[model samples]
Target: MMATTHALAGVALAVLVGVLFPESAAGTSLLPVAAAALGGLFPDFDLYAGHRRTLHFPVYFSVAAAVAVAVAVAVPTVTTVAAALFLVAAGLHSAMDALGGGLELKPWLGTSDRAVYSHYHRRWIRPRRWIRYDGAPEDLLAAGAFALPALYVLDGTARTVVLGALGISAGYVLLRKPMVEVTQAVVDALPDEHLDRLPARFVEDFR
Candidate 1:
C-alpha cells in the first residue's frame, strides 16, 4: 500500500482511539496522532536498510517499546509520549505492510528461511493483498471508507485536513501510474547534473 494510505489509516486509528478512550492521556495527546501518522511512514525507511526485513519485525518493536515503558518511570513525560508514539506509529506501519502480504515478522527468533509473513485474516476471508504497492484501486476504496466516516466525527481543522488528505490519496491512486511514466520520461530527458541533483527517493522510484 502507499504511504499516504498508511498515514491516513494511522490518523484515523488515532482518532478512533481518542473516541474510545477519551480520558486516557495517550488518547488525548496530539503526539500519538502525529506519531501514528509518521509511524505509518516509518517502516518504508527499510528501503534504506533492507526492504521488509529488519524494521518490519513485530517482536523487535515490541521489545523496544517495553524498554521505553520501563524507562518511562524515570522520565514520565518524555518517555511516556515516546513509548505511545512508537507503539502506535511503528506498530501500525508494520501491520499495514503485513496486511499487504509483505513484512517479515519475528526475525530474531527465526532465520530468513523461517521468517513469516504477518497478516490479519481468518480462514474464511483472504488477507489484504488485494492491492499492490502503489496505485491499487482497492487503496482508494479502503481509504475513502475510513476517511469519509472520519469526516463526520472530526470537527474544524481536523476535518479539513482529513478531507484534503482524502483528495491527495485519491489523486495518487488514480494518477500514480501516469505520473510515474511522465516523471520518468521527464527525468530521462534531463541533463546529467539536473538528474543527479534530483532527490534520491524520487529518482529511485523511476528505477
Candidate 2:
C-alpha cells in the first residue's frame, strides 16, 4: 500500500471507531483526529534511517496507546481522543504493511523479520509479486471507497484527512512516473564523481 492509502485508512478507521463508539470518540476539536491521521505517516519515518524496521514496529504504538490510556485516567476527555486517533493510525498502518508484504516488524526488538512476514504471508496464500507498492487499480478503488465518508462526514480541518488522501492518490497517479523520469534524468546528467558521493540507494536505483 502507498502513503495515501495508509492515510485514508487512518481517517476511515477513526470515523468508523467514532461511529461505533460515539461516546469514546474524539470531540469536535480536530487535534485528536489530526493526531491519529498524521500517525499514519509516522511509521514511514524510518525511511530516513532503517526503512520499515525502526519506526514501523508495533510496540511503539502500544507504548503510545499505553501512555494515552494512563493520561486518560487523569484527563479523560482529551486523552481519550488522542488514544483513539493514535490506535487507528498505528493499527491501520501495520495491518496494511503486513498485508502488502512490505512489513518487517522487528525494529529495535530482537525479533525475526522472516518469521513475522512468513506468518503474515499465510493470510494471502499467493505469490508475493502480486503485491504492488502503488499504481494498482485496487489502490485507486480503495482510495475512492475510503474518501467518500471522509469528504462528507467532517468539515474544515477534519475534512482535510480525506481530502489530503484523495489529493495524494491523485498526485501519485499523475506524477509518479514523471517524477521518476525527472529524477532519473537528473541522476543521469550528474557526473560519475558526483554520483559516487550520493547515497548508495539513490545511486543504485537511478544509475
Candidate 3:
C-alpha cells in the first residue's frame, strides 16, 4: 500500500485504541496518533536499501508490539501509550504488506512473488495482491476507508494531516504508473556508470 495508506491505517488503529480506552493518553492527545503515523511510515524507510527485507519484520514486530501493548496497558502514560502504538503500527504495516502486491517496478503486473520478507521464516512471503498495488484505485479507496473515521474523530492539526494525506493519495494513484514509465525512461537514458549507482530496482527491469 502507499505510505499514506499505511499511515492512515495507523491513525485508524489509534482511533480504535482511543475509543476502547477513553481514559488513555491515546484519547486525550495527538501524540499517540503521531507516533502511530510515524511508525506506519518507518518500515518503508528501508526502501532504498533492502526495501521490504531491511526493516519489515512482520513476525518480530508483531511479537514486540504484543509485549509493548501489555506494558502500556499495565501503566498507560503518554510515553508508554505512544511507544506501544508505535510498535503496533509498525507491526501492522509490515504484516499488511503481505496482503498487497509485490516488490516490483510494476507490482500491478503481479510479476514478482516477493511481497514482504519474514526473517523468522528466513524467506519472502508471496504477494496476496488483495489491493493490486500501491497507489491502485482500490488503494485510494482503502485510504479513504481508514481516513473517514479519523476525520470524524480528530480535529485541528491531526485532521489537517489526514486531509493532506488523502489529497496525496489521490495524486499518487493518478501518477503511479506514469512515474514508473518516467523512471524507466530516465534509466534507459542514463550511462551505465550512473545507472550502477542507482538503486537496483530502478534499473533492473529497464536494463
lDDT of each structure?
0.59, 0.59, 0.93
Name model 1 segments beyond 4 Å from true. Answer: 45-58, 65-82, 101-128, 186-207
Tens-digit lDDT track of model 1 for 97-136: 5455322221212222312233332112113454543446
Order of the predicted models by TM-score, top scorer first? 3, 2, 1
Once fitted onto the true fold, the runs of candidate 2 whose alpha carbons sit more than 4 angstroms away are 59-75, 101-131
Better of 1 and 2 by TM-score: 2
**TM-scores, one per candidate:** 0.64, 0.72, 0.98
- For model 2, how does the per-residue alpha-carbon lDDT over 132-187 read when each residue is reduced to its tens digit? 43545566677778767667678877676477778778777676556767877888
Model 2, residue pairs in steric clash = none
Count: clashes, candidate 1: 0
List, residue by residue over 1-207, the lDDT tens digit for candidate 3: 999999999999999989888889999988999999998999999989999999999999999999999999898899899999999999999999999999998998899999999999999999999999999999999999999989999988889999999999999999999999998888899988787788888778788
Q: What value does the lDDT take at residue 181 in candidate 1?
A: 70
**Clashes per prediction?**
0, 0, 0
